[model samples]
Target: MTKSDFPALRMTIDGGRLVPAGPFDAERLNSYRRGTVVYVRFTEEKDRVLVRKWFAIIDIVLKQCQTPWKNRDQAHEAIKLALGIVNLSKTVGGDYMQYPKSITALEDPELQEALEQMTELLSRMTGVDVATLKKETAHIVEYEDHGPTTGEIIEHESGAASPDADEPPSSSSAGAAESPSSAAPTNTDTTETPVADLVSVETSGDGDAPTPSPGARDPETQRLIDFAKDVLPLAANTETTGSLLSAIEKEWAPEIKKMSADGQEKAKAISRSMRAIFNRQASLNGALDFFSDALGCSVEELGG
Candidate 1:
């Protein structure tokens, strides 16, 4: 529908976010119909002129992965990179919040599978070949010396480790193996390696994530990194967002403009949250002339 269909959510400028005001009831929970749009409003710094925009948490999360992941590893590379920046934003207590726990939790099969699904979906969504990162994962060497695949486990006993991954005729372990149909309990530990240990997005053989060319990335990219790290939390510095938008318009406008309506929206949604930060921060200066098509963040909010 239109903006009139959604309820209003007021977010105050605390420091670096647009936190909803109140005890976080139904209006703030976002558990209602997805169609229920929530428009955020901010009174101008000095003018008190009303500025409003839709604030969607799910949309923002989806936007971050739109950059066209190179693969699961590459996506996590970005995740690791982004996580480092987020951790840099410390509280007065001087402790880094363990954020985006995906880094540490990748070992969980469910998370790994979900991430893989996301990588594939996001790749197709952005039309960027991020799945190529699987090649880096393929290059890893695995050892089967720990235990046999869970399928080969014996009843009421842990799966035995194999000496070689390929040549596997352990004379002593012959009768211990059980058929898949066997109605016996099997061990938890098995040959299937943890995905996190098998493939690290944080490194490409050098044990470090990829780095942006200090001078090569556009000002928007640089500024976004700083903003995620909270270096510019108090101020979104919309000037930077405006510059990036101008650059995108100049370089990608014609091509992006020609894209399908859905494609155009996806492209525009790219890095919308970061733009919101700059826009919200710029509010401190009073009236703002610039706005991004990405996501909403016309004011900074800090939590207690």
Candidate 2:
């Protein structure tokens, strides 16, 4: 019989035998054939709770911000894109495509990493303090035990659960949770110099590209340079590149406003480095030239 003929069953695997956990139709149990293979799905309540908390955090952030995204799914995709939590592939037409992995499927370590990244982005976007947000959202996941004990039994031949199936449908969109892949599949090609790898670049000793002198080294500038290198590659491939830049710019504005003239000049230099790195991925020289022109200083100033 087809899977549809079998009744839904919730059971435990005890010593290689299926032990029904609760009331199940006895009539349907007889339908099982000897040696017939049945599929099983194990559910992790902790993971489910974490997913709930993630959506809750997104809901709070979306409610407080004026973002291009209209709903949590869109916001989730945007955050993943900006943070580089996605896979890349090319279409037949040679356009790039991003497949943002569903957070529900992430392993524990990856899920923690995603939580950290999402929290950082949400804080930057909404001006909400990360500590406060974390404290407020921590208790938001109220677990319900109404469902089949921790694991559920199934009769499916093969395949996996839909990414969209993990969460309930949102009011912003009907039916079911929107999958990340549901977004536009095509993207403009952004292949250029790989920005992250350039952090290790050594000066060739030729006048072609000058290395920063040790005397010019400033801890703060070095920190910004390292930050810029980490995120620039992720930003370049996203259609919301402007959005990422705008968020960082927003974060920098107030700090810039409070600086003294000299401090403001230094802040401007730092800002130039950020903008240059984000705007031009064409060549190393192009990015450096933009930084130098904007800073109106020697290339070595990038280190300070």
181-246 in candidate 2: lDDT tens per residue? Answer: 222243443222111112232324452324354356454444444434433443444354777766
Full-model lDDT for every candidate: 0.32, 0.47
Write one digit per residue (lDDT tens) for candidate 1, span 1-304: 5534433433554689666454432364555577766554555321110100000111222222223333333333343332121222455897433333333333346444434433433333333343332322232223212223221212121234333322211222132112221113644543221222222223347433343353754444333333323323323443465666456445655655665553444344333333434443122112111111011122231110
TM-score of each: 0.22, 0.41
| Number of clashing residue pairs, candidate 1 | 9
The most accurate candidate by lDDT is 2
lDDT of 1 at 157: 17
After the best TM-score superposition of candidate 1, give how far the Cα of residue 193 lies from its true spot, in angstroms: 23
Error of 1 at 210 (Å): 16
Candidate 1 clash pair list: 17-301, 69-130, 70-130, 71-130, 147-161, 236-278, 236-281, 280-298, 280-299
After superposition on all C-alphas, the RMSD of every candidate to the true structure, in Å, is 21.4, 17.6
Candidate 2 regions with alpha-carbon error over 4 angstroms? 1-47, 93-96, 141-304
